[model samples]
Target: MIQVAAAIIEDEQGRILIARRKPGKSQAGMWEFPGGKIEQGELADDCLRRELMEEMEIEIDPYAFFGVNDHHYGATHIRLIAYRARYVSGTITLTDHDEYRWITARELTAFTFAPADVKFVEMLHSSKPRLNE
Candidate 1:
């Protein structure tokens, strides 16, 4: 199983960040929490921090283990681990995605996310989750 890490990045205003996959990517045009696959000997948190820096050119302080989802598309199996993260600093520059946005949780249902992210979206129907506030 492929281990992937995702960040549900929330800003001070409670807006969560989402990224749209570029055309050449696997799930082209689909929106998702910005992150990448975990590498050997890397912790999920470290992977998230590294991925956010690499993919969005931003830094984050990830916290509160959110949830996990195991999914299969055709033959590809992935275990997506998510966490609530605070946007620390940096300008938004998407490297792996075509577009990105900081949206409220309620607006999440409007955008089509990658299948593995659906559960997380559904559970986040309200404003910032009841995480450590």
Candidate 2:
């Protein structure tokens, strides 16, 4: 199974950060969490940190474990390991994604996300999660 690490990035206002997949990419145009696949021998936390930096040019410290989801899309299968990460510092830069936005939980349902992310979204709904003040 493919190992992927994702972040539920929450800002001070309790808004979550989501990225839009670029054209021609898998799940193109879908809004999903900022993360990428884990490389061999890399820790999930490290992979999340690296992917955030690489994909969004932002740094994050995975402060808490959130949840995990296993999904299969027939052709490809992935084990998505998610975490609640604290945004540290850095200007937002788009590398892999076409666009990004900070949206509230109620607004999340408006956008389409990868199937693997649905569980995390539900978790956010159940917990009404917020960042540290």
Candidate 3:
């Protein structure tokens, strides 16, 4: 299974950041918590930090372990590790995503998320994420 890292990044208002998969990328147009694959021998936290920096050019303070999900898309198996993070700084940039949004947990269901990220959205619904508040 391939390991991946994902972050539930919250801005000062407690709105979580979600990104749309860019055109030509896997799962293009689907929304997801911001993050990327964990490189070999890389720590999960480090991978998350690197992904946020590389993909969106934003800095975050990841503070707690969120959860994990195992998913399969055809032949690819993914183990997604997630963390709760607070937005630290930087303008929201999109290199890997076509768009980005900061929304409340209640608003998550409105967007169609990638299969691997569906569980995270469900979890947020079961209980709101009070990241900034």
Q: Tell me, by TM-score, which candidate is best.
A: 3
Q: In lDDT terms, which candidate is top?
A: 1
Give the per-residue lDDT digits (tens) of candidate 2, residues 1-133.
8999999998878788999999989889988888999999999899999999888889998888888899999978899999888888899999888999988877787888988998988877676545441
Candidate 1 per-residue lDDT, tens place, 1-133, comes to 8999999999988888999999999999999999999999999999999999998889999988999999998898999999999999999898789999988887899999999999999989754554433
**Relative to the unseen true structure, what is the Cα RMSD of model 1?**
2.6
RMSD to the native, candidate 3?
Answer: 1.8
> Between which residue pairs do clashes occur in model 1?
none
After superposition, candidate 3 runs with Cα above 4 Å error? 128-133
Per-candidate clash tally = 0, 0, 0
Superposed model 2: Cα runs more than 4 Å off: 129-133
- Model 2 accuracy (lDDT, Cα): 0.87
Alpha-carbon RMSD to native, per candidate: 2.6, 2.1, 1.8
The model with the greater TM-score, 1 or 2, is: 1
